[model samples]
Target: MENMHIVFWLLKDISWCMIWKPLGVAMIFPTLIISIVIAWRTRQFMSELCHNVAISVWISANSYWMISEFFHFDEHHIWGGITYKHLALIPFITGLLILMYFYLWWQPRNKEETEIIEA
Candidate 1:
């Protein structure tokens, strides 16, 4: 009975690592291409490019994490005391970078509008 549970868990882990991870990584390019075409038609190419790049970074992090796990690279500390499993930081940092870039650098801020908000 205990062996059956172990087998099921192993199969689930295998499917996640082999099937789902690569599938997600593989789908990014087609989605980016489609986004580019639509953006060009709408004359919003730069916006779409930024969005696609951000998406790619996020997906790349997932792929990296899975690859690292499969190869056991995630178990060792590559730099600081934290283990390589912390490689997921790439995606997290990327998300924060984009969030700060858009909110701080790109968006237009006006004092009058800021003060008038009802929230």
Candidate 2:
């Protein structure tokens, strides 16, 4: 009876540590990619809104991963302990910042019509 109880506890612990953690991590990539594609395909005001929202979501995910690493969330985990994991945030955040800067700053101003005076 004791052995059976131990086995059950062991499996439960392993399921939480091994199965759910990786599944959560795996969900981020495809979600980000699909969001980016959908944002790009959207038109006019919706396009800008979708793109910004997607970028924000991606940045938030990267920030969460960084926080997870700094607090040693992956210390004894099956995956996500490598140095490269933290480094991956650089390009993602950089690209998002650049895109935002261009969208907000570099876009051309719309011209307003003015009445022309005839000489």
Candidate 3:
């Protein structure tokens, strides 16, 4: 029946079409409220620094994923030395590397127990 075909098309096409709403909810909402709250509550420079840097990394990755997947602007390198298309990725990759360094190197320093461990 025509109605059955329409139902199937709607189910398959419409349901699978949109993911931006959920992504925005997950990415934007927490960064706005929770990350800032956690950073401010700590009142320590390292903790706040780590949280803010992590947020930047997250934003860059989210933008990269959204633009590449949804807009399809990431199909191929535009050409020339580091084309315009590749420029968008610089911050994303750099942010990730910085975040990694913070987590692996800097995070451990926060736990140094000068009273117990030093003795």
What TM-score does each of the candidates earn?
A: 0.52, 0.39, 0.43
Which TM-score value belongs to model 3? 0.43
The numbered model that scores best in lDDT is 1
Error of 1 at 98 (Å): 1.7
Q: Is candidate 2 or candidate 3 better by lDDT?
A: 3
Best by TM-score: 1
For model 2, the run of ten residues with the poorest summed lDDT? 110-119
The residue pairs that clash in candidate 1, if any, are none
Instruction: Write model 2 residue lDDT over 1-119, tens digit each, in one string.
Output: 33443343344345345555554444444545544554555534433544555454654455455446544663444446555455546656666775665456544232121111111
Clash pairs for candidate 2: none
Error of 3 at 51 (Å): 4.1
lDDT of 1 by residue, 1-119 (tens): 33443343344346555656554444444543444454345444334445555654654565567667766688898777888879788786896687567557654453344345423
Candidate 1 vs candidate 2: which has greater TM-score? Answer: 1
lDDT of 1: 0.55
Q: Give candidate 3's error at residue 1 in angstroms.
A: 49
Per-residue lDDT of candidate 3, residues 41-61 (tens digit) = 554566455656565555555
